[model samples]
Target: MHRITGSHQVQFLDALHRDHVEVEDRVRTNKAMGLARLPSKSWRVNKGWVLTCNLAADLDAWLRLLTLHDDQELARAEPETMRLRIYHLPARLACHARRRLVRIERTWPWAQAFTTSWARLTALPALT
Candidate 1:
């Protein structure tokens, strides 16, 4: 790395450090979503694993942006918290009027956030 010089060096260094921290945060979150270790020795398998991790990260970001806008706690939640509270909730599937429905216990602590996110997602127009 080239050494930055001149009177602006401190400002440049601060900006660079900020960017570095952001990158590290992304990697930490990715690890939290199962990217901490590769599960296979094969190159192709590792590649697919990495892609899956990336997709999970993207979906988390979009979920926060599109559905969790009003909830500050959930909007800023880490990957593991989201996995536990939203994705891994106890639920049952049922069908009614030709529509499949997931039924979660009303008393679950995160139930409201989960249902709100579900409603927001369903209300969006489907991609053709």
Candidate 2:
């Protein structure tokens, strides 16, 4: 687990952990309710990377870092841009998945897809 500091960060981390459980439960429930097909075992691997710490701080920092990196890369716009874009992809995907899930209907199929995508995205390796 990541070291959490500050009460707000701790609270956010706790909520994140709880949200992971809730998502897993909802996925199981959807399967039981015959709402959506469960993803394969391979897909489940993504759950391992689900948020264990408060990302609100890290995400804010990442965005700022990305902006700075992007500015520097834009001047070169070749290998640098490609590298920077690849580095930023995971964060972009996570943000997109979060937004998608927020608007997704509570139906079983949509829930399953949302959960699967969310899990897979979070599990993606960070840039070296």
Candidate 3:
């Protein structure tokens, strides 16, 4: 089984710090979806770790649409940047999102929205 050591945890902490700096710089540069910080914590679950911001904003939009509510306001808004804020999220959240996406696809039959939302949520690191 995989175990997380202090050093491995530090790497993620460092990434969060770096991301804060980058986000601040982006804000100065007038960039949209500038940056946000995720909460920090220690846990021993799923043989790994996860850290991320709650994507309540995006989820709200989806829920609104599903309910035939006023999604117009949400439509004009840009996509959530929570994924970019956190370098990693717990494996459980990832799995949960994946499962939620599957359910959404089954009920909505709109694969494009689900695919785009999943991609946005997963926002893995870019290759150098």
Candidate 4:
């Protein structure tokens, strides 16, 4: 029911279709993050559940896009693998003076990447 374009239309549609496919892939990831089922009877609670899932998704994206952006292996890892390698990786928490210190195990396989990414993340200017 719409007008047709020239040969450039095929290129534009190809790019658009690729983006749509990527979005569908992300939809599957969001489901993995707990968006698959809203397990609450109350509407308010369901909203909160969605919000929490979005927060998790945002953090996952940040870890990939910012922390491991330049790292080939880690960047290509799935969300579950990423969580296992980075977030759930064992670390000793210590309180010193007025602050806390997270001391990751120096023997871990990805310890160097973890420390390098941590340093880069912290070196960012304060969020005013």
Candidate 5:
């Protein structure tokens, strides 16, 4: 429970509490994404590591927002889950005619989600 001074309406306090919770959630996620450990003794090296972690977190957020929005499991997946199921999958790119194709085992559990994400990403307009 939090104690607040002054007269505040219930709705306003609840909204403020929710916003704080959301920020705390993000901080927890960031810690899980590598902010929990500072592996280097040097300040510069630690700064670089933090930057790398931030980049990875941004990429993860984008992946969920852009490609995995329709996939509930993947949209809420943790970093390690995404890595094991999607990023580190055994797949091969094959050139057939004028198009490239991704070939993966049909029996793979998350194969459909992976292929759907790939197709969605490939269908995006290229930047000029």
Candidate 6:
């Protein structure tokens, strides 16, 4: 869309191309998440739906980066893979000794991955 020059020419071009690719990837992801449909006839209602969809996508992205970044397969996984493996896996939350704990089937294939990711997420510095 614009010219690139000076000391930052290659850097700018690389960034621009990467951003374009990322946008395309996000568009596909959004479609997979049902963002292609307008939930209501009214523009106002549709606007709200769009906001909700975008928020859900953003939250999914954060969860993937924060929770599952350690595993190579998971780190590159799309939202659908994440949903099946991590989000929809059943777990029970309980409070014990004033601390909340999540209990899951010990035999679950990804239980360890889930717990490790959870611990890493909790240990991260709070975002400002």
CA lDDT of each prediction against the hidden true structure? 0.90, 0.43, 0.40, 0.83, 0.85, 0.82
Which residue pairs show collisions in model 2?
none
| Model 4 TM-score, all chains together | 0.83
**Mind giving the per-residue lDDT tens digits that candidate 3 earns over 1-128?**
12645645767779878999866653432222222432234344311322111234334445434432333433333344223212122223234644642333233333344445456555645679
Residue 23, candidate 6: alpha-carbon lDDT: 96
Q: How far does residue 64 in candidate 6 sit from its true spot (Å)?
A: 2.4
The candidate that achieves the highest lDDT relative to the unseen native structure: 1
Clashes of each: 0, 0, 4, 0, 0, 0
Which of the two, 2 or 6, has more TM-score? Answer: 6
Compose the digit string of candidate 4's lDDT tens values, residues 53-75. Answer: 98998888887788788899888
Q: Which candidate number has the best TM-score?
A: 1
Candidate 2, residues 27-89, lDDT tens digits: the string is: 453333332333335645434323312243244334434433434533223333333443333
TM-scores, one per candidate? 0.84, 0.22, 0.20, 0.83, 0.79, 0.75
Q: Give stretches of model 3 more than 4 Å off.
A: 1-109, 126-128
Q: Best to worst by lDDT, what's the order? A: 1, 5, 4, 6, 2, 3
Ranking by TM-score: 1, 4, 5, 6, 2, 3
Give the per-residue lDDT digits (tens) of candidate 6, residues 34-123.
Answer: 689988899999888888888888877887788777789887788788777787878888999999988898878878878888888889
Residue 44 lDDT in candidate 2:
51
Instruction: List ranges where model 5 is wrong by over 4 Å.
Output: 1-7, 93-101
Error of 5 at 127 (Å): 2.5
lDDT over C-alpha atoms for residue 39 of model 6: 83
lDDT per residue for candidate 5 within 61-97, as digits (tens), equals 8878989998888888878788889888888889999
Q: Judged by lDDT against the true structure, how good is candidate 1?
A: 0.90
Candidate 1 runs further than 4 Å off: 1-14
Error of 3 at 79 (Å): 12
